[model samples]
Target: MRTSYKNITGLGSAHKGVGHFIKQRVSAIALLILVPLFLFQFLASFTTGYSGVMAWLGSPFGAAVTFLIVSAMVVHMRLGLQIAIEDYFGGAIRTVALLLNSFIALMLWLIALYALIKISFGG
Candidate 1:
C-alpha cells in the first residue's frame, strides 16, 4: 500500500484496531453507566420535588458529573448517528442529515453546559 499523510484512523485502517476497539467498548460501557445514573437521579428528584432536583443538579460534583455525562453522550450520539446517516441516507440527503445532526448535537451540548453552569453558579 502507498504511504500517505492521512492517519490510519482517518483512512479507517485496521492497524490501530486494538485501541479503537477499546475506546469503542469503553464508551459503550460509559453509556450503560450514565443512563441508569441519570434516570435514578431523576427518580430521586421525583421523590424530593423541583427544588431538590435543582439542588442536586446545582451541587458542585453534580454539575461536574453532569458535564461529563453530556460530553460522553454527545460523543456517543455523534458516532451512532454518523453510522445511521451513512447507512440510511444518500447523496444530498445524507449530507443534509449529517449537518443537521451535527447542529442538533452542538445545540444540545451547549444547552447542557449552560444548565450546568447556571445551577453550579446558583443562577
Candidate 2:
C-alpha cells in the first residue's frame, strides 16, 4: 500500500471538525425555527405597550423561548466566526480573533439572559 503525500502530511482530518460542523448545522436549524417565532412575537407585541411586553416575558414559556433563541444564536455566531478566523488568519492573529469572538458571544449571551431575567421578574 502506498500513502499519498497529502495523507502523509496529516492535513486531512482535524477530528473535531465534524463536531463543529454538526453543531453549526443544528444551531442553524434551531435559529430557523426560533427566529420566526420571535419575529411574530415581536410584531404581535407592537401594540401591547411596555407593560404588556413585560408581562409576556414574565411567562415561563416566553422566557424559555427567548433564552433558547439567544443561546442558539450566540453559539451559531461563535462557531461560524471561529471557522472563518481559523481559515483566514494564522498564529497570534487567529488566536486573538478566536478569543475576541468568544468573548463577544459570551457578553451578548449574558446581556440577553440578564434582560430576560429582569423582565421575567418585573425588574
Candidate 3:
C-alpha cells in the first residue's frame, strides 16, 4: 500500500468539497429560476406607481419570493467567492480573503433583508 504525501501530511481532500460543489450547483439553479421571476415582477411593477409597487411588495407571495431570491443570491455569491479565494490564495492571505468575503456577504444579506422587511411592512 502506498500513501500519498497529502495523506501522510493530513492534508488530503477536505472531505467537504463535494458539499460545496453541490451547494454551488443548487444555488446556481435557484438563481436561474429566481432571477427571471424577480425580473418579471420588478418590470411589471414599474408601470405602477410607488403605492402600487409597495402594495405588490407587501403581498405575502411577493414578500416570500423576494426573500427567497435575496437569500439565495447572497448564499450563491458567498459560496462562489469562497471557492475563488480558496483556489487562488494561501495562508494568511487566504484567511483574510475568506473573512472579508464572508463579512461582505453578511452585510449584503442584512441590507437586503432590511429592505425586504421594510417593503413588506410598508415602512
Candidate 4:
C-alpha cells in the first residue's frame, strides 16, 4: 500500500478546490452568454442615440439583464484574482490581497448595481 503526504499530514486544499473550480467555471459560462448579449444590446442601443439607450436601460428587462451581467462579471473577476493572489502570495500579504480583492469587487459591483437601479428608476 502507498500513502501520500497529504494523507499522512492531513493538510490539503482545505476544502477550497472543487467548489471554487465550479464557481469559476459557472461564472465564466455566464459571462460568455451575457457579454455578447450585452454588446449586441449596447451596440443596437447606440444606433438609436442617447435617449433611446436610456429608455431601454430604464426598462425592467434591460435593467435586469444588465444587473445579471455585472453580477457575473464581478464574481468571475473576484474569483480569478483570488486564484492569482493565492498562488503568488502567502501569509499576511495573501490575507491583505484577498481582503482587498473582495472589497474592490464588492464596491464595483455595488456601484454598478446602484447605477442600474438609478437608470431603471429614471433617477
Q: Best-fitting candidate, measured by TM-score?
A: 4
Per-residue alpha-carbon lDDT of candidate 1 for residues 6-56, written as tens digits (9 for 90 to 100):
463553454544554556567788878887887777687768888887888
Write one digit per residue (lDDT tens) for candidate 2, span 16-57.
Answer: 435787899999999999999988886776579987777767
Q: What is the C-alpha lDDT of each candidate?
A: 0.78, 0.87, 0.86, 0.88
Which residue pairs in candidate 3 have backbone atoms (N, alpha carbon, C) closer than 3 angstroms, thus clashing? none
Supply candidate 1's per-residue lDDT for 120: 77
lDDT of 1 at 119: 81
Candidate 1 accuracy as TM-score: 0.77
Ranking by TM-score: 4, 2, 3, 1
Query: Per-residue lDDT tens digits of candidate 3, residues 1-123?
Result: 898766666545764435777888898999899999989998898789897778778888788778889889999999999988999999999999999999999999899889879887667
Lowest lDDT sum, 10 consecutive residues, model 4, at: 8-17
Off by over 4 Å in 3: 1-17
Q: Estimate each model's TM-score.
A: 0.77, 0.82, 0.80, 0.83
- After the best TM-score superposition of candidate 4, give how far the Cα of residue 67 lies from its true spot, in angstroms: 0.6
- Candidate 2 RMSD to the correct structure: 4.1
Runs with alpha carbons beyond 4 Å of true place in candidate 4:
1-17
The predictions' CA RMSDs to the true structure, in order, are 3.6, 4.1, 4.0, 3.9
For model 3 the TM-score comes to 0.80
Could you give candidate 4's per-residue lDDT for residues 1-123 as a string of tens digits?
A: 899766666555473436778889999999999999989888888888989899878888788778999999999999999999999999999999999999999999999988888888767
Task: Enumerate residue pairs that collide in model 1.
Answer: none
Q: Quote model 4's TM-score.
A: 0.83
- Residue 81, model 1: lDDT of 85
